[model samples]
Target: MNIYLTRHGQTEWNTQGRLQGWQNSPLTEKGRKDAKLLGERLSKIPLDIIYSSSSQRALDTAKIIKGNRNIETIIDDNLREINMGPWEGRILEEIEKENPVEYFNYWNAPHLYVPLKGGEYFEDVQKRSVAVIDKIIKEGKYKNVLVVTHGITLKNILNYYDNKAMENLWDTPFIQGTSLSKIEVRDEGIHVPFFGDTSHLE
Candidate 1:
């Protein structure tokens, strides 16, 4: 199966450099335009199913990309972004200033990093996200699957497929908003054609 992964379009929080976490935010004008461009690009590909995060931002992006494709998106909570707990509505700068040590650890040494109060652990997120992917691949119903999800969730999957260490979580290049990544999964192993492709926006 070929999995096409993409992060949702930019939200107001994204532009403001806030931690979106599990919170909701509407897409900006450019976000919608980029999504439309992605839709136009994806329309040329052969997609059988779309699995989208339940988050509003991801759902909105999925709808835009699926545009008249006659494919019904399956919303899965497991695909939601990492829960930021108290950091959900806070700006990233504020979090960095307040929790300097932990924030530094999060981006640098993620294996030793801990989540905010009431937040989930990165390991937990990876487990659930991996479970979803495993189930989808096991089903073998769809040959081409598009997963519209958040950055961290998508990164977790990428890390899993690449067999990278937990400490290397943030080492991979960032997944840009509305960008596409194509990976092929076969009986042997996973193969990535590309990561963070935004030519459609260009």
Candidate 2:
């Protein structure tokens, strides 16, 4: 199966540096344009199915990409961004100021970081995200799919296929909004031909 993964476009919260986990936000003007551009790029490809997170930001992005196409987007909760719990809606800078230790742990040592009150565990995010894709693949259908999701969720799935440690989750470069990544899954294993490519927005 071939999966073309993309993070949802920029949102108001994104511009404000807010932690947008599980919280909904409207896409900014630039977000819409980027989505449109991505849509143009994907429109040239042969898409058999489309999947998007339940978040409005993701749904909107998917819709923009779908445009007038007859494709029906399958919305799934498993594709939703990580639940930030108490951290939702709060500016990331403020979180760093109020709880430097926890914030630092979340970035540098995700495995050791404690989940915020009512927040999701990193392990859970990775497991659920992987399970969703596995289920789709096991169904033996939907060979080519476009998955519109969030940065954290997309990162978790990418990391899983890369065989990277959860602790290094934030060590690499940030996953840009509206970026693209392609993964191919076969009986042998998973392979990432490219990851987090945002050249389309350039």
User: Largest lDDT belongs to which candidate?
Assistant: 1
- Model 1 is weakest, by summed lDDT over 10 consecutive residues, at 187-196
Q: In model 2, which residue pairs have backbone atoms overlapping below 3 Å?
A: none
Model 1 stretches astray by more than 4 angstroms? none
- Compose the digit string of candidate 1's lDDT tens values, residues 1-202: 9999999999999989888888989999888889999999989888999999999999999999888889878999999999989988788889999999889987898789898788988888899988998898888898999999999888888888888898999987898899998779889888777888999988
lDDT of 1 at 86: 90
lDDT (0-100) at residue 114 of candidate 2?
Answer: 84
lDDT of 2 by residue, 90-133 (tens): 99989999889889888888898888789998888999898888
Q: TM-score each candidate.
A: 0.97, 0.96
lDDT of each: 0.89, 0.89
Q: Which candidate is the best by TM-score?
A: 1
